[model samples]
Every structure is written in C-alpha cells, then in structure tokens.
Target: MKKESRQKESLGRILKYMKKYWLFLGLSIALAVISVILTLYIPILTGDAIDYIVDKGKVDFTYITPILKKMVVVILITAAAQWIMNVCNNKMTYNIVRDIRKDAIRKIEILPLKYLDAHSYGEIVSRVIADVDQFADGLLMGFTQLFTGVVTIIGTLGFMLSVNVKITAVVVFLTPLSFVVAGFIAKKTFSMFKLQSETRGEQTALIDEMIGNQKIVQAFSHEDEALESFDEINERLEKYSLRALFFSSITNPSTRFINALVYAGVGVFGAVSAIHGGISVGQLSCFLSYANQYTKPFNEISGVVTELQNALACAARVFELIDEEAQVPDAEDAVVLEEVKGDVDLEHVYFSYEPGQKLIEDFNLHVNPGERVAIVGPTGCGKTTLINLLMRFYDVNSGTIRVSGVPVKDMTRSSLRSSYGMVLQETWLKEGTIRENICMGKPDATDEEMMEAAKASHAHNFIKRLPKGYDTVIAEDGGNLSQGQKQLLCIARVMLCLPPMLILDEATSSIDTRTEMKIQEAFGRMMKGRTSFIVAHRLSTIEEADIILVMKDGHIIEQGNHEELLQKNGFYAALYNSQFAQS
Candidate 1:
C-alpha cells in the first residue's frame, strides 16, 4: 500500500476505537475552547493596561487594579480548563490503547498457524509491547497538543484580525510555509522510522533467542560469536535510529526559522500601522501578541513531529498485525465431533508446507478402530507434519482425512481437536501448581481423577517428593523440573483429557532408560482400546505396535508389524538395525 493510504487506514482504525469515548472527547474539546478564549483575553487585557498607562502618562492604581485582577482570574480559569482537558485526553488515549491491545491479543489467537510459524515469537512480542507503548505515548502527546494547539490558532487569529486585518493577513500567509517545511521533513523521516522499528524488532528477536539458549551458548563456548552477531544487529538499529532522528530533528529548527520571519513581519507592519494612526498603540500590542500565539501552535506541532512520525509507523505495524487474515472459517455445515470411534482414514492426500514443495502426494492410509500405528522416520521426513494435518493445524492442499467416516474438514476445529490428545517432544508448562497443570486439559476433573491420571503417567512419585507436592508452583516453562519430569506432567495432562485418539510424538525421547520403561508401560495401558499414533526414533519403543510404517521424503516406504518389517529388510529394517547397532 502507498504510505499515505496506509497511514489513513491506520488513523481510521485508531479513530474507530476513540469513537466509544465521544462524550469525554467532546468535553475535552469544550474545555480547550474555553481555555483558549480565556488565554486570548490576557493579551487583550495587557494591551488595555498599556493603553491606560500611556494615556494618563502615569501609574493609576484604581484603573490598573481591576485589569490586573481580571487577568489573574482568567489565568486561573485557563489553568483549570487545561487540567480538565488533560484528564479527559489521558482517559481517552489510555482507553483506546487498552482496546487496541485487546484486539491485537485476540487476533493472535485466531491467526493461522502458518503466519505464526513464519514470524518469530520475539517480533510478535515486540509489536505487543514496545511498538504499542510507543504508539500510545505518541498519540497522547499528539492529541493533547493537537486539540489545544488548534483552538489556540483559531482563537488567536480571530483576535488578531479584529485588532488589524493587514497584520493578520501577513501572519496567515507565512504560516503555511511552516507546515510545508514540517511536511517535507516528516516525509523524509517516516521511512527511516519504519526501518528503525523493523531493526528494533530484529534486535529484540536476537536477544530473545540468545537469552533462551544461554546454556547452549556457554556449553559450545560460542560467546564471542554470539556477541559479534548481537553487535551487528545493535549497530544496525543504531544506524537507522540516528538517521530517523536526524531527519525528524530538522523540523524544529526549520519551523522556528520560519516562525521568526512571521514574528518580525508582524512587529514591523504593526508598528507602521500604529505610527500612521491606522491602529492604536494598545491594538498594535494586541496584534503582536496574537501573531505570536497564532504561529506558536505550528512550532509546537513541529517540535513533536518526530514523535508523531514514530507513532504513525508503529501504528501502521500494529494495524497490519490486527488485519492479518485469520484461519480459514469452518464449513457452514460443519459438524461437532462427539463420541468418536478410533477409526481413521486418509485417501489420496496431497500436502506441502509451502507451494510446489510436494512433501506428501497421492498418499493413502486406513487404520481400524483401536489400532496402534507407529510412524518411524529420520528428521524432516514429514513425521510431525502428518500429525499437524491430522489435528487440522494446517489444512491439506487436497484430498481428505476422515475419522469414523466423517471428513475431518467437515468438523469444527474445536470439535475435531477435542477428540484427540497430543504429547509432543517439546513440553510446555505454565507457572502453576502440578495439579493445576495436569487439570488444564480437564479443568473440572476431580482430585481423585487428577491423581489417577498423574499416577498412570508415572508422575505421582515425583509430585509426592516435591517440597509442597502438587501445590508447588511450577516456574516459567517448568524450569524447576527436569525435562523428563516436564514431559511426564504433560503426559499426565493428556491422560486427564482421555480422548479417543492419542498422538505421542517423541514422548519419551529425552527421558532416561528407566523413566522410558515406566512411561512405556503407562503408554501401553493408555493405548488399549484407543487409536494411537506414535512417532519415535527409538526402534525398541514401537516393537509391539500393531503396525509400523517407515517414512522417507513424505512417502511411507515400508509397513507392517515389527517382525514383518524386519523380514522385508527394507527401509524400516535398515532404520531399526542402525539404531540397534548404535545402542
């Protein structure tokens, strides 16, 4: 999109959020108007005091007292009005920011898996935190100044014109030049600010990656390499930031110079009129004050043009994220999968993570209810990708995967996913008690039920040994627990879910031999009478599976039970023998 159109769209989105606070906004504007009027009256009173003293050619206490008193009262009222205006503007800005954050967060939930996969988590987090904060702060400063600045301009001009039209005309003519300068600099700075924002996100992503993998960096002795990489990113951010700020900084000086010319013009022209008797000395004083006030807003806006540009760039990014296409909608006739039987079938399925890659083509599979199917493959062999397709995280390029004769695509995602329980290689645990984490899959599960699930997954012993048992709060990502223990807790969660279809992808890969034996026993009990799909690198784990399929390059090269696959001496046999030899 063109920058202008994008900015307009972003601004329109911002205004939509502000629309809900119309009453407060109106009150803010009303207070600004009153403040501006009261403020403008001060210069008039000052001019009146000058005229009175000049006429008498002496200090007249009686005459000057009321004017001074009224000026003080007006100043007090303007101060009060400004305070109320600020309160309203702050309330409106924060409320709008709150809504923006809510929508952004909600959008992330519904976004397609592909989008999240392609973007780094740190970049998304930057948009949620740093970018949003920058936008909100800039908007607050811009709107507060914008409202009062505009009122000051209009009111100052009216008073100036009433004092002397000729001087008012001079000031008005020179004012647009200030905006022209500001606009030119703003145009040059915007693209730089955008680059700066992008660079900042990259820097944040690098930091996040490094911090998350600190152990690996230290173990590999790659601190120098990491530091060099981070320095490069930091330098890039600094370069872009310097260029953006340089261009933005030009606005203030250039506008100030233009303002200086307008002020000089008002002084000279108003003095000429006063001497010619075309306007009184008092009127000339008022005209000069009005001229300064009239041009001051332009200078004020110029001063914050940098902030405004940063806000716009940040807002554009925020709006872009909010407008990302969500996951494809469920079919109109989608059914709610319930009481699922374990049968699954795939017919002539074709899929690829990206177009033309052709990972899986013309694939077909059929498994009876309550069967255990083990998929064995090397890395990047589409092992987990197949599971992703089964869960509808990504729709197939073509063909259908059905459960119990119903095409999976015809079912709502929530319903389809609810029918299956999954435990993956990477474990995810939040900062909650062990019991709470296990109960996540079935929140209303009873204490007895949760304990039963924990015991079945072999997590009960560890829970009992913990300082506070199940009540001990897990730290972020279960840092307090071992990798094996975290995996067990995750398995416990799946056990509590009790779905008809179960997927175990490298569930025991990280565990020790002893733990694996216990987990395998737990899995054996859990897999009974349920459809199970196991993806594993350990050949021994799947020896008793009803069916074993060896995959290569997205194609199933060999299949059958453990004994049958070894007899074929095909891909499966080679894979099994290789792991057996290594062990």
Candidate 2:
C-alpha cells in the first residue's frame, strides 16, 4: 500500500509539471484521435475495394478506383497527424525536464551547509543530471507510445463491434488475459527498477571519488584497493539492473503470445460465420484487420508499462531531493551593516557539530577595532569551526557573537559576510581567466585596482609571465595552475575586497619561505588598521601579534603577548619551544 501511494504521488508531481504545457498536451491528444480514426477507416476502404472484385477479370475498375484513391489520401493525412503529434510530445517533454533541473539547482543554492557536508558531491550531481535524464526518456516514451496505443485499441474495438458482434466478443474476452500478465510483471518489476536506480547512484558516486583523487590513490599505492571497491559497487548495480530487465522483458513477449491467441480466435470464428452466409467476404476481411489492430496495442502498452515503472523510480529520487528542508530564513527585520568598525565580541559561546560532543563550551573573547589577534591551536582544536560560526555558515548552539556592536544573528548573512575578508588554506577557483578570478570578490573592480591587489599579494609577477597574462583561462579548480600560484590568486581575491575585518587561516601555507616573507610583509601592511583573526600552525609567524591565543581541546588555555606568554612558561611557552626545537 505504501509503495502504491508513493507511485501515485510521484505521478501526481509529474502531472503538475505538465500542467503548464496544457496547450501542447491537448494538441497531441487531438492529433492522436485523428490519426487513429483515419487509420482504422483505411481497412474499411480496402475491404470495400475487395468487394468490387467478384472474379479477377470481372472486377469493376470504375468503382474500386475511387476507393483506392481515398485510401491513399487517408494514409497521407494519418501520417501527417502522427508527425505533428510527435513534435508536440518532444517539445513538452524537454521543457518539463528543463524546469525540473532548474528547480533542483535552485534548491541546492539555498540548502544548508550541514546538508551539503553530509552528502557526497557525486550523489547530488547524479540526482540532478542522470536521474533527470532518465525521467525525460520515460516521459517521452509514455507520450509517444502510451497515448497512441490506447487510442488505437479503443478505436479498433468500436469498429470491430460495428462490423460483427460475435467476433468482437472474442477479442474483448481474451483482452483481459493480456492485462493480467502485464500487471503481474509490472508490479514485480517496480521494486527491482527502484533498486537499480539507487545502485546506479552509488556507482556514480564511487567513480567520481576515485577519478577526482586519482593522484592520491596512485601516490599511496592503493590502485588495487580502489579497483576492488569499484568492482563491488559495479557487481551490485549489475545484479539489480539484470533483475529489473528480466521481469520487464517478460511482459512484451507474454502479452504478444496472448494477443496471438486472440487473433487466431477472431480468424476461426469469422471464417465460420462467412461460410455460413452470415456475413460477406468483404466484411470478414474488415473484421480480421480490426482484430489485428486491436491486439497490436496490447504489445505496445505492455512495453510502455515497463518503461513507466523505471521512469517513476528515477522521478521519486529527484522529488525526494527537491522536498528536503531548506535552511531557516533570516528574521523579518534583519539589520544590514554598511560601515563596520571591526569590533568583534563573543561571550559564553557553546557549539558542536553534533549534539553531546562538547567541542566548544563557554568560550569568551573580546577584540577592539584594529587589534591584531593571532590564534594558534593543535589539530581538531575548533579553529575552523570558530571561523564557520563567525561567518554565519553555521549558527552557534548557544551564545551571542557580535560584529560592530550588533549580534551576528540579528544581521542578514549577506551583509555580515561581506564585512569581512577571508582566505583559507584550501583554495578554490572557478573555470575562468585570472582577472575574473581575482575580481570575483569585486566584479566591477577597475584594471588598476585589480593589478594593485595582485601586486600586493605578490601574484602580479607570475601573472605577467603566463602566455596571455591576466587573460589566460584557468582549468577547473585551477588544475592548470601550480599550488603556490593558486594560493596567490586566492590571496589576491581577498586583497581586492579589503573588508574592514580579515580572517587568515593558514593563508600562506603553500608558498616558499622567500615568497612567504614577502607576503607576510604585505599582510603586515594590510593588518595595520584593521581587525584581523589569524589562525596559524607556525608559532614564528605570529610572534608580533598584539595578543596570542593558545588553544587546546576547544578551550583557550593561554592568552597574552609573545614575551608575556614565554616568560610565564605555560602551555603557550611549551608549544612555542617545541616548534623551534624541531626546526
């Protein structure tokens, strides 16, 4: 019962998408009716022409000629109608698929960060691209085959009954057998097809992960392990796909066999009736044609039933993604900060990615405008999590973080994020030219402004050496650029914005020591009159900060200037000494 309900819901949603194209749908249906009615009329004309031939030489050419001519015209009109109907179906199907993809992408943009973090990128792509394509194929088949098949069946049955009641009864009586066989197979195949779709998604995700990180897999000598994992997923996909195809394949042949029986029944009974002088030879001929036409649709409809099951399964997966809960909206009267002074304060803050994990508890901090504060923490010390909270990517579990004397939660996320310039360790660049990437934070930046920002980040020298300089197009994720060059471009991006507040989370980790010193000097000039939060692993880079924060296990264990912390010989002193000892 639950499965039936879900199928109905999936179909209902699909119909809603089609509702906007009602004009095209109506035209297609009207064309199907005209095509089927005229196609059925052709056999009657043929039967009439046959009646005019009593004996081959004695046939009346004058009477049969007009009927033959009429048959030709009817065939031409029927073919034209069918062609137009198909054009309508194609237009409607593609437009519906376009709308579905648009909705899926828009939903992804508004989805919460937590949801994206939990799902694989490959799985999401599969839902939006692969599943939508499957749905379009199924819908197109339903439009072309299903509608015409149904109309043909109904038209032929009516014409058959008009010709002779007894023969028509035989066709009707045996028709239910075809339906019974098809229904049983269809019911059994839906579950199998559904399983096949899920397995395909898993396989796509596994392949995406392996291919995207092929360098890492080979570097670690895990090629065999990667292949083994892929094989496991591939085997599961094969099992489910074969099972689905097997059941669906039976529907067409099984119905064809039953249809053959019905045709034979009509031929036997009509022959007996004709010999007894109950009906003319011409009438018998018409009945046989009607019987053939009637049973042909059963074969087509059986095939359509199988395809529809697969389509519904893929549609269900896409609908599930579209129905996911979006992120909570901002308050109705959210404030928009325009001129931030960079005064940030956090008091009694509590947060954890998961409940009961107890990562950050009662955290407190205060920094006035233009303070250069550096944070040094071991791995898994909530350094990045703090950045996420301040950016409002994830709200705190409890507490208030204020920027420029306004609670971060009270301000719109757009305005809050735009007030700060951030550069992270993991660099991301879209597929575009170097100038486009540098100007991402400020799209309307002038050429002089863009070049100045790049020079300050020490990326101008490298940019000029490229074949096209700033006009050179970078590959996806900046794959064409070296690691240090990519990092410089990212830094140049933040420099272009030059917001009132800055967050540098290991911003120079990939640069050489010489470039690092030059970039550090640039950073010193950038940080002179702005509030900066620097999260660093190297203790030497942050010795000149106004205040140094040493964190361990999500708590701020030590806080002071460099000399003050070293003289105290606390956790900060020990950490500072350990780094130099290793060097």
Candidate 3:
C-alpha cells in the first residue's frame, strides 16, 4: 500500500511537468470534440437520405445534395482537427516522458551510497526502465484518451437527447448494465497483470545475476543450472501474462455484446415510433447517430482501462526508487575543506553492520600531518572497515572521526573525499586509453603533471611499452592487462590526483616481488610530506612505516613501529612470523 501511494505521488509530481503543455492539452480536447461532433453527422446524413427517399416517390439533387455537401465539409474539418490533435498529443507525450526520465536519473545520482549498496542492481535497472514505461502508457496516454473520450461521449449523448428524448433513454439504460461487467473484469485483469509484472521483474533480476557471475558459471561448469533457474522465472511470467490476457479479452467482447443489444433495441423502437407518425425520419436518424457516438467512446475505453491498471503497477515501482532517501544528504552548513593538512584522528570509534556484532570497537588512531602509518591485521580484523570509516563511506555509531580539526560528518562528502587518494586491493579501469584513466584522477591536470604522477607510481615505464603508449586501448575492466598492471594503473590514477592524503590498501600485494620493490621505492617518493595509511599482510612492506598498528577482531591490540611490535611477541609478531618473518 505504501508503494502504491508512492507511485501515485510520482504521478501527481509528473503533472507539474505536463502542466506546462496546458494549452496543447486544451487544444487537443477542443479538436477531438469537433472531430467527434462532425463524425456524428455521418450517421445522421445516412438516415436522413433514407427517410427522404421513403417519404417521396422520386429522388432529386435538391433533397440529397445539401447533406452530401455538408458531409464533405464535415470530413475536411474532422480530418484537419484530428491531424492537429495527434500532433499536439504526441508533442505533449514527448515532453512529459523526457522530464520524467530526467527526474528519475537525476534522483538516482544523489541517492546515498548506502542505498545503492542495499539494493540489487537489476531491481534498480528495472525501476528506471520498466517502471517508468508504465507511466508512459497510463499516465500520459491515458490522459490523452481520457480527455478525448469524455468530450466525445458528452457531445454524442447530448445530441442524442436533443434529437429524440424517449429513444435516447433506451440507449443509456444499457450503459449502466455494462458497467457492472466492466468493474468486475477490470479488477480481475489488474490482479493478473500485477502478477505478470512481478514475475518479469524476478526474471530480469535472475538474468542480471547470472550474467554478472558468468565467470563463476564457466569456472564451475554450472551453465546448465543457471539456465534451469532462468527458465523457472520465465515460466512464472508467462503464466501470469496469459491469465491477464484472458481476463482482458473478456472486457471487449462483453462491451461489444451490450452495444449490439442496445443498437437492436434502438432500431426497433425508432421504426415503431416513425410508423406511428410520432417521430420524423430525420429525427430518428439524428438520435441513432448520437447513440453511436456514446457507444463508440465506451467501446475503446474498456481496453484502455485495462492498460491503465498495468501502467499503474509499473508507476508504483518507479516511484519506490525515486522516493528512497538520498545516500548522503549534504548538511545545510557543510564547510568546504579548502586544503586539509591530512592530520587524521579517531576517538572511541565503534561500528557494526548489524546490531550485535561490532566490526570496530573503541577503535582509536592518530596520524599527525605528514606521518606514515601501516595497519596490519587478520582478514576480518576491521582493516578495510577502518579505511571505509576514514573515507566517510560510513559514519561511526559512537565516536568521532576528524580530518584536521573538523568532524567528517560536518564536511560535504565531495569536499572530504577530494582530500584523499585511495587505491583499493581490487582495481577498476574503464575501457579507455591509459592516459584517459590517469587524467580522470585530475580532470584539469596538465599532461606533464599526469605523467609525473604516473612516474612516481612506476606506471610510466609500462605505459611507455604499449604500442600507442598512453593511448593504448584497454579491455573492459582492463582485462587484457595483468592484475598487477591494472593495480599499477590504479596507483598512477590516484597518485595523479595529488590529494593531501594517500591510502594504499594491500597496494603491493598483487605485484611480483621484483616489481613490488620498484613500486615500493616509487611509493616512498609518493608518500613524502603526505600523510599515508598502508594496510598490508606482508610484514616486509610496513617495516619502514613511522607507526604500525595491529588489529584483532575489531580491537587495536598492538601499536608501535615494526621493530617494536616484533619485540612485543604479541598478535602482530606471531602473525608476522607465521606468515612473513618466519621463513
């Protein structure tokens, strides 16, 4: 129910964009009314000609020519008016759809990082594409049909009553009876349609998951299993689609039958009234024409209503995404971090992904300006969590983290992030030239400056070896490059940013030892006069760090330079000897 209301709110919001085209809307309705009124004249002309022939012995141009000429005029006017309506309606639809898509995309951009982390990628994709499509049909197209249909129905019914009041009663009497059937079938069809959409969303999600993990599927030879799972989702979607189709099919035929019965009654009554001399030939003709206008509008309206329900379901999903709170709403008074000195401090910081399990408990660390710190621990000892907190990716639950002297939460996210350069254990490279990837770190950096940063990270030599050097094309995720090469490129990229602080999380773990030595030397150059945090399991990598902190199960158990930790014979020493310092 909340989802439904959200979708409705989205629809209402869309109207504001549409409200700009109010003139077009009014013009389209005006044209449709004129076209419908002109069309109603056709049936009147048909019946009037018949009545004239029956009342007189001979037919002459005087009696028939005027009606024929009037019909030609009506046809030309209707054709012109219809062309105008189609043009205006189409223009209106385009503008509305464009704005809606833009709003959805723009909102997605400001959505918090946590929201993106929480939701499945496939579900997000579906909301943007599949859900917005619903509003395209019902909200926009339905708006078009509704305005035109109401105008036509009203014009037709009014003409009918003015022509012969008594006969018009019979035609309208049948309308109320059809409503009962329309209401029942609309309810059933909507339920089935909703089921179909749910299944399709599931199927989309399954396919997205399978494709994203295609490497695992091929490695484990589980392609067939994946295919079977996909088929199950497909089958459910098909079943629901078929059920909706059946119920929707009931609506049109049922309306057609009701229309047929009403037409027959109107014809019989007209004949009897005319024969008794109570009505004229032209009068009955006009009455039937008016009745036709009413029935015709409803004839198509029933189908449109079913489609509206389907669109409504889609709208619900889209609004659900747009309504999600932003990932990081900026503080009203967030100060820009002009130039941070990279003095970082953490005090009594505690955090947990869930309530009961703390990932970091009372974690405290201080890195003065230009100091170099290395954090080492077991895999789950909150190594990465510390980095994440420092980056302000997640705010602490019970403590304060400061950059310089200000709490991180008080700084705008963009400003806080701009002060640090980070190279993760895993690296990513967009499919582009090496130069483009590096320059992305500092969009406005000079070419000489970028190359200098790359040189400092030891990436310049490898880049020079490529055929086109910096222009060499990398495959998606830089798959063509070795893991170490990608890591080196990421290193160069972050280094180019020249941020006040640098974080190298297992930065050298993937490279060959020989390359690690060269990169380490280059990293020493990169870290000069910059506060740096290095997280590594390799004890040899951190021996030169000014401060070495050892963590275990969310607590900082040991802190000192490497030589000091080795002397303590605690967790850090045991870990180093067992993994690195032993052999």
Candidate 4:
C-alpha cells in the first residue's frame, strides 16, 4: 500500500521537471490529436471503397484511384506532422534536462562543508551523475510516449463508437484486461528498476573508494575484501536488471493476445449481423479496419511505459538533490567589502555542531589592524574551529564576528573571503606545472611577480632543477615532488596572492631541518606589512608574534607574547621542552 503511494509521489516529482518545457509539450499533444483523428479517416475510407463497388454493384477506376491516393496523402501528412512534433519535443526535453542537471550540480557545489560531512562521498557522487541523468532523460521519453498514446487511444475509440455501437463495445471490453496485465508488469518492473538505481550508486561509490585509497587498502592487505565488496554490488545490479527485462518481455505478448481476442470477437459478431442482411459489407469492412487501427496507440504505449518507469525513478533521485536546502545563504542585498585593513573581532562567540554540547563558549579575541598573532593548541582544542568560524564555515550561535568593524554576515561572502591568504598543514596541489599552481593563487600575477613569490617561498630552486623549470607538470596531488617540495610550492602559491591577512596553519610542520630554514626565510619575506595568523609547532616562528594564544577545549587557557607565556610556565613550557628534546 505504501509502495503504491510512493510510486505516485515519484511520478509527481518527475512531472515537475516538464513544467518549464510545457509549450513544446503542448505542441506534441496537438500533433498526437491531429494524428489520431487522421488515423480514423483511413478505416472510414475502407468502408467507402466497399460501398462504391460491392453494395452499389459499380466499379470505376476514376473514383477509386483518387480515393486511394487521398488516403496515401493523409497518411503521409499525418506521419510527417507527428515526426516534426516528436523532433521538437526531443530537442526541448534535452535542453530542459541539461539545465536541470546543471542546476543540481550548482546546488551541490555551493553546499557548506558541514553538509558534505553528513553524506557519504559515494552517495553524493551518484546523486549528481547517475541519478540526475536518469531524471532528465526519463522525463522526456516517458511523457512523450504516454501522452501521445492516450491521444491516439481516445480518438480511435471515439471514431469506432461513432460507426457502430456494438463493435465499439466489443473493443472497449479488452481495455481492463490489457490494463490488468500491464499493471502486473509495471509493478514488477518498477521494483527491479528501483533496485538497479540503488545498486548502481553503490557500485560507483565502491569503485571510487577503492581506487582513491589503493595505498591504504594494499598496506592493510584488504585487496580480496575490496574485490568481494565490489562483486556484491555488481551482482545485485545485474540481478535486478534481469528481473526488469523478464517482466518487460511479457508485456508485448500479453497485449498481442488481448488484441487477437478483440479481433476474433468483432469478426464473429459482424459475421452474424451480415448473414441476416442487417449490416452491409462496406460497414463490416470499415468496422474491422477501425478495430485494428484503434489498438495502434495502446501497443505503442504499453511497450514504452516499462522504459519510462525506469527513467522516472532516476529523475526522482535527481530532483531530490535539487530540492534540498543549502546550508548557507547570503542576504538579498548584501554588499562587498572595499580595501580591508584586516582588523578582526571575535566577541563572546558560543557555538557547537550539535545542540546542548558546546564546543566553544564565550570565546573572545580582538586583533588590531596589521597585527600578527600566533594561535597554538592540542588536537580538538578549537584552534581550527576559531579559523573555521573566522572563515564563516559555521556561524556562531551567539555574539558576533566582525572584519574591519563590519559584521561578517552583512558583508558579501565572496568579498569577505578575498581578504585573507591561508596556508594549511596539508598542502593540497592539483596536477599542474609550478607556474600553473602558483598562478591559481592569483590568476592575474605577472611573470616577474610570480617568480618573486616563488623566490620568497623558497620554491624557485627545486622548480629550476626540474626538466622544464616552472613549466614542469606535477603528477596528481603533486606526487612527483617530495613532501617539503610540495609544502614549499603551496606556500609560494599562497604568497602569490599577498592578501591583507595571511594564515599559515602548521604549513611548515612536516618539513625536514634543511627545508625548515628555507621555509623560515621565505616566511620572513612573505610576512612583511600584513596581519597573519601562524598555527605552527616550531616555537621560533611564534617568537616574534605580538600576541600568542594557547587554546584547549574551545577556550583560551593562556594569552600573551612569546616571552610572557614562557614566564608563566604551564602547558606552553611542557610543549617547548618536548620540542627542544626532539631536536
């Protein structure tokens, strides 16, 4: 019972995509109407042929040839009209589907980091590609076939009834029988298609996961386990696909049997009436032709419904993504910032990802214009959380965050983000040359400026040693470079932009001693005349910071300059001792 309700809901959702292309849809229906009405003329002409010869006992090549030629003309015109309508429908539907797919992607792309965190990577990927594809393609083909089929069926039946009520009765009786058989087929087929859709999403995700984490899988000796998981998803997809095929196979044969029964029944009834001389040979001939022609629309429809259903299922998944509310939205009339001086204020900011369990409580901090500060903490200490809130990844539940005395929310997000230069611990790079990745940080960077940024970041030497210098192609995720080289390139990339504020969140923590000296020299050159936040393990980097913050469990445990914090001697002292001991 619930299943049937869900099926209707799925269809309604699928129909929603067609609203935009409804004008072309109307043209398709109008064409179907013309075609159906014209089809009835052929059967009527069959009656006329018999009447002109057998009933009147007269034959003339002159009249018969013209009548037959006219039928051919009508057939050709109607066929041409239907073809044109179908072609327009196809073109319009494809555009609508493409636009719908693009919008769904746009929605997914702008979604907040938290939303991505909530869903599996595989599930999100499937929803974007396979599911969206199905929705658009299904909407086009299903509506086109179903709507045209109905028009032909209704028109054919009306003309059949107008000619002889008894013959119309004979044909209409098969309607319920055809529907019942088609209903059984539809139910079985829908279930298989649904299973197939789900299986395909899982398979796509599984393959992506295995390939993405091949290193870990191999290290853990999980190759056989991974293969087994993939095989399981593949097997399920094949199983459901075969079931849909089996049910669909039965539809044509069932419709054929019902059609045969109707024909035979009409023949037997018409023969009895003619034997009594109650019905003429012309009327019988026309009535028989009408019966055959009437079933034309039904045959076309029943065959396409199975296919249409599968497409509808795919569309259902797609619209679901489109309808989802984005995690963030800017005000309609928000304004962009102009010439930010990087004065930041975090005032009594209380926040949590989950309700009633606060990760940050009454957190307050203020940095004057062009002031450089270093923030340090243990893992899960809200060090990154402070940066995240500053970035507006999540909004504070209470209090306010301001940039240059302007509320972050009031300023347009794009303008607000453009004010900062951030370099993180994990320096993620694309598959590109040294200049390409550097250029990405500032697209308008001049050649001299680009090289200067590289020189300051200490990435110039290694780049020059490579085969093509700055033009060398780095492998995926910068695999061709050493860890230190990758970090240096990322720093150069960030330095290329030279925004008013800079953030280095453990950016040089993973490098060896030699690279560390080079990175420190680069950092010195990059830090001039800008407010920067340095999240680092190397205490020397923080020694020159105007203010130092020690964060733990979402609160600032201690705050001072490097010398003042050392004199206090608590968590900061222990960390300092450990660092020197390791050295």
Counting clashing residue pairs in each candidate, in order, gives 0, 0, 3, 1
Q: Which of the two, 2 or 4, has more TM-score?
A: 2
My TM-score estimates for the predictions, one after another, are 0.95, 0.97, 0.90, 0.86
TM-score for predicted model 4 compared with the true structure:
0.86
lDDT of 2 by residue, 513-551 (tens): 999999999999998899999999888789889989888
Task: Return the candidate ranking by TM-score, descending.
Answer: 2, 1, 3, 4
Off by over 4 Å in 3: 1-17, 45-59, 62-69, 278-289, 431-435, 455-476, 479-485, 581-583
What's the C-alpha lDDT at position 285 in model 4? 85
lDDT of candidate 1 over 82-160, digit per residue (tens): 9999999899989988998899999999999999999988888988888989898888988788888889999998888
Highest lDDT scorer: 2
Stretches of candidate 1 exceeding 4 Å from the true structure: 54-58, 275-281
lDDT of each: 0.89, 0.92, 0.82, 0.81
Candidate 3 per-residue lDDT over residues 1-583, each given as its tens digit: 6644644665576677779999988898888888878887787787777666754567766888888888898899989988888888888877877776777898888886667777778878877777667657665567667767778778777777767888888988888867787778877776677677777777777788888778889999999988899888888888899999988888889988887788888889998999999788777776666666677666677777777777767765666666777666779999899989889999999998678976888888888999999998888989898888998887788899999999998889898888889998888889888888988868898889888987887788888999999889887788678888899889888878878999999988779999899889988888999999999988888899999988889998899998899899988888888876436
Candidate 4 C-alpha error for residue 294, in Å: 2.7
Task: Let me know the TM-score candidate 2 reaches against the reference structure.
Answer: 0.97
What does the lDDT read for residue 306 in candidate 4?
A: 77
Task: Show pairs that collide, candidate 3.
Answer: 111-327, 112-326, 112-327
Write candidate 4's Cα lDDT for 359-450 as tens digits.
Answer: 99999999987777899888888888788888787888898999989899888887877888888887788887778898886888899999
